[model samples]
Structures are given as C-alpha cells and as structure tokens.
Target: MEKIFTLFLFLPIFALAQKESIWDLEELYKTPKYEETDLVNKKGVKSIFYESIDYKGKPTKVYAYYNIPTTERPENGYPAIVLVHGGGGTAFEDWVKIWNKRGYVAISMDLEGHLPSKNHQDRKNFEGSGPSRHGVFHDNNEALQDQWYYQAVAQVILAHSFLRGLPEVDTNNIGITGVSWGGMLTSSIAGIDDRFKFAIPIYGCGFLNGTDGLMGQHFKNGNQAYRDNLLTNFEAEAFLPKATMPILFINGSNDAHFPIPAMMSSAKAPKSKTYLYVEDGLGHGHPPAWDVEESYRFANAIIHNLPLMDIQKTTWDHSKMDFSAVVKGVRPRKVTAYYTFDKGKWQKRRWNSTPGNIKGTKVNAPIPEEATAAYLIIRDVKGMSLTTEVIFDTSDKQTMK
Candidate 1:
C-alpha cells in the first residue's frame, strides 16, 4: 500500500516533467553536429546538412542554404534570419539572395528532407532524412519523437542554433519566417523558441479546427483520440500563449487554408506584442506569401529598434452602423475598413473596402447593413500595412440601423 501510494504521489510530477521536456530546449539550443556540402553552386551561397533529433530510432539530417552579404558587417555581426519553406517548397537559393542583397545573413532549409535540385518537386531524399510530412494529423497516434511535425520543429530549432553559432551572425538579432505550412511551424516555434528576435508567419495560424481548409476538416472528422493528440502535442494554439517575442501574423482575408478567425486567434495567443497584415485578395504561394513588404518592414523594425505600426483597439457601433479603430506608431497614410455581408465559410465570402475617416489616431468607417464581420487595414506613409483584430456580428439579426 505504501509503495502504491508513493507511485501515485509521483505520477503527476512525472507527467509534468515529461510535458515540460517536449522540445528539450537546452539540448536543441546547442550547436548541432553538421557537415558542409557543395551540391549547389549559387555564388556566395553555401549548403550544408545539420544533424537533428533522432526519428524512429535512427539519426536524421536537415539540408540548408546559408549566405552572408559581401558588404561590411556590423561590429556585433550581421543580423541573420532563418527561412522555413512551406509544403512543396525546398531550400531556395533565390530566397537567400534576396536577404543577402539586403545586407542580412540568411539561411533557408528543406524541412521535407530533400536535397537541392533543379526540380523542387522531383528532388530525391538524401540518406538519413527524417520523416516527411504525411499530413497535418496523420501521425497523431505515433510517439511524439516519430511524428513529422515534431521532427520539423526540432529541425528548425536546430537551424536557429546553427545560425547562432556562426561567427559572422548576430545571435541576438536572428529572426525566423515561414510560409504556409512553414508559417504554421513558425507560429508554433514563436511560442516555443523565444530566442528569436521576431517571427513572421505568413498565411499560417492556429485553431486549425476552425478553418475551412484540409486541417480543419481533418480535425472535425478525425477520431476524438487523434484529435486530442494533435491539440495536445502539435497545434500552434497549444504553444502560442508561451510566446514572448514580437510576431507578425500575415494572411489573406480569403486565404483558403488559414482563415481570418484562426489568424486572429493566433495573433491574440502571444503574450508579446503582435501585428497583423491581412490583405484583401492575397494569393497563396511561396512568392506571393513572402512578397509582402510588411514582413520585411516588421523584421527591420524589431531588429533595428525602429517604430512599428500598432492598432490599439477596434470597436463597432451597431446603432450608427460604424466601425472605428485606434491606431498608434508610424503615421497612417491611409486607413480602410474591409467588411463582408456574406455569412458562410470565410474563404468564400466577398470582401469590400470603404475609405476610413482618420482624425488624430482614430479611424472610422461606415459598416454595411447585414454585415457579418469587419476589420480595419492601416497603411503607413512608407506603404507598410497592419490590421486590426477581426470583429464578428454573431446575432441572429444581421441588419443594423
């Protein structure tokens, strides 16, 4: 009886310890074992394979492309970035060059365990590749160490550590950005890896079950057990509350995969300051996703201590049929209210914008009758944009005034 009692007493402690050690930050923060490779020959760009956490009881390697600017570096070292590619994308040399030209050291890695090839889709996996992504929740029943999401996050964290160890890289100024699925990973990492100076997650946010995308469908139709596993172990929502770094959540109002509601939830999850940039009709793809100027501006603002655009609060006056937002930081050159009267899935809803009246720091616009939801977009004089949290009218009667 005493032995059993003692075991029960320690069970909760054991469980807590196990939960806290999920990513093993101490181990992941260490410089990973790596080997340089010459498979790709883009000028000034170097490719390498870094060791990551074990998978299915075997070792794994993550391929990456890194480059430094030819321009003079700061005394503290050049600010660096780790780029995580989305699903169906690989380590892109062009992506690295874009950052290198901007005078920032950059590294982009293939999370799918593929080698650099002319054809990204047909690239072959090198030996010791970790598990490829099967689906969002396909491997929920497997042990955490054997799951694809777990492996990918570990590899990204490893990449951050690798970049931090570089002699010419500014460890304190390193940031991360991921597009699409990679964006989802960035959202999760933002909460887990507080080492990043800032994070940009494009077209990716948590609350997958709330979206109309494949992840949402899977979460809704999946078995209760698997769903529970995903929510507990893999969902970005589960980890975002712990984020302590500034995060910029970028997405489109009509994004097919990650809808506005989910992105709002992710933006609100972080305790640290967060900004949003939900474009009116932004398309989903690597180029389109990364092409947003707000991303670069936000990263620059955070890394260089420049002012960032902040939307303080948004309110809806039903009686007046008006929506208003309080803006701060970086004077707004334009403010617009985007609203939708249609009330089905977010992706299919048509969005229309109306010019807002800006007085002092407040911007106001008239809300359309029967409007189901609305949000404000504030563009600064520099052409950078930021958004307010989305507001929804959930009443049975939609018509106001």
Candidate 2:
C-alpha cells in the first residue's frame, strides 16, 4: 500500500478554555479519600482505597496499588507516576514495582472499579463492577451524566491531586502512562489534567470515530447523534489540542486497537513537544507489547529535565529521505531505516531494514521504491535501541481503524 506523510506544526496556539470543562476541580479536590489497605504492604508498594464520585453523584471507592521509591531520594522529592491499565486489567502491582525500581512513586488504579485479582491468570475472570458498557466508547443511555468516562476522568484528575498531596512525591514532576484503553484515557487525561508534566500513551489515542476499520467503526455504525456524543465527550482528538504538557506517543505500526491514521491524527492535535515510537511487529497487550526501557528513559529524562533523544527534522526528496536526531550525551553504534511496502495491511507486512550512514547527527538512506512507510532506528552503544514513528508514508488515505 502507498504511505503518505504530512508535517503539521505542533504550536501551543489552542487554549484550554476552547473545550468546556466536564470536571469540577474544586469539588473533586475538596477532600482526600486515600484510605490505606493492609493487603500486601511491601516496603515499596502500598494498597489503598480512595473515595470518588460515581455517575449518580454518590460516593464510591476505587482501589489502587501505590509504589514509592526506596532508592536515594531526589533533593526535591521523588518524581511520581500514575499508571492506568487497559480494558480487562486491574491495579497491576507489578507495574508499580517496575516504576519503583526505576526510582518513581507509581500508582496503578483500576478504572473498572474492581480490585486486582490474586494472580494474573485470575484477572480475566474478575468482572469489574463499574459501568462496564457505558460512557467509554459509546453510551446512548445517559450521555455524560452516567458515562463511565466522566467518572473515570474525574477519578484520574483526583489521582493527580492525591499524588500532589503526598509528602513523598515531587508534585511538579509527576507523569501518567497507560496501555490500550488506558492509553486512550491517558490521552484524555493529558489534555484534561494540565498538572501532568508529561504523558506517554502506549497504543492509545483519540479520533476513534474518524477511523475507517479500527475502533472508529463502533461510532460509524451508530446513529449520527451517538457518534457526535462520543466524539465530543471522550475522543482524544478533542482534548489533545488543548494539552499544554509534552507527550510521547508509543505504539506498534500494526496495532489493531490504535491504527496509524488515527494515531497520526491524535499526534497532530497536541501543541506541545510530542515524540513518537512506532515499532514494527509491535501489537496489543502490556509490558513487552510496549518498550519498558524507552518508556522509563522518557520518564526519567522528563522528570530530571534532560534533553530528549528524538528525530528533530526530516527532508524527503522524492525517493530519498534525510533525517537528523539529537541523542544527547550518547552516540549510536549504528543507524538503520526500516520500511514496509504493503499497500494497506500493516498488521501482516514484514518490515525491511536498510543500514544508514550517520554523518555527525544526520542519517541518510535511499527510500525503497516499494516502501510506503518508514522510520529511523538508532542503536546506541549503551545497548539501547531507539526507534522513531513513521516519518514518511506515501498515502494519507483513510483506511480501517
């Protein structure tokens, strides 16, 4: 299939006031409900329950596993993160531990309002009690009043506030990251909650309704009123433009839940310093489906205010593409250009990589005649392989979501 690439300037021109506020920050921040839990209180991770407002304006409890760093604390305090799980996932204690090991105070909460199962294998059977089918993608029943996203977004906003209230965390350095559905939620949160210093959404983005075959079909088949409601209330494309914080968009080139066009459309909305990590053969799921090292490297750099390693510029000359990157404080052992020629089916397309020459900070490579999309990958001498999102595609045509 033919790929197309468009360069849109991500300027901070959109104001947050452009979108109507769906949350009452004053009411949500009026009090704290992080009740401590005695379930497996390790040296680093602590389980807790916090009060949140449900759809009916009643008090509801949300369970979460919070992990605080035990390593040498930063002078300002430990940087923190809020971890969000995807559909069918609960508070992942292991996820919290992973961040804690990297010196961050991490909290993983369940959006479905269910506590984590005893083990990973039992998670699939644990039916969440929250509004399972409402207010996420499509909710024709009660609009925003009883939408699950309304409550979930509020809970997430409260999460950031709760983290700021903690004495062990550096409130100004906190960030949020999520997988799958959580990634989409993270996209909304990044735009909704300006308190986050940075956001890394793994295989999730907005513009779902605009997609051809992906998640967009859900909205496409619905009535126009329902489709408009979902887009206005929960789509990331609506919120990302107003987001003031920087974002790192990570996903597989062939991810089914988050297609390239939708991902690109979402990425184009953010006016902040946005980065991309679109890898070949990457798919859905957690951890391995995502790159832990790159994710943490991004978090660490942002928290410590370090320069990001990313492609800075791209120059496409018909059949050849020239690129430049800033890999601060490190040098790459080798640089390569990876591309796929498939017309439309990226999921089954095998990526062919061509070694490129790095002259100073610029990498040059001849574009494959049959290539439709491609990106640059840098394997630093430190044994870390860093990849960029598709910098070039021959077609911008809308396809399956």
The CA lDDT of each predicted structure is 0.81, 0.71
Alpha-carbon RMSD, each predicted model: 8.8, 4.0
**Lowest summed lDDT window (length 10), candidate 1:** 3-12
In angstroms, give how far residue 394 of model 1 lies from its true place: 1.0
The residue-by-residue lDDT of candidate 2 on 68-97, one tens digit each, is 777999888999998878876778888888
On residues 249-363, what C-alpha lDDT tens digit does candidate 1 reach at each position?
9998888888776777677777899888989999998899768888888888898999877787688776678788887888888888998878667778899889988888888
- How many clashing pairs in candidate 1? 0
TM-score of decoy 1: 0.92
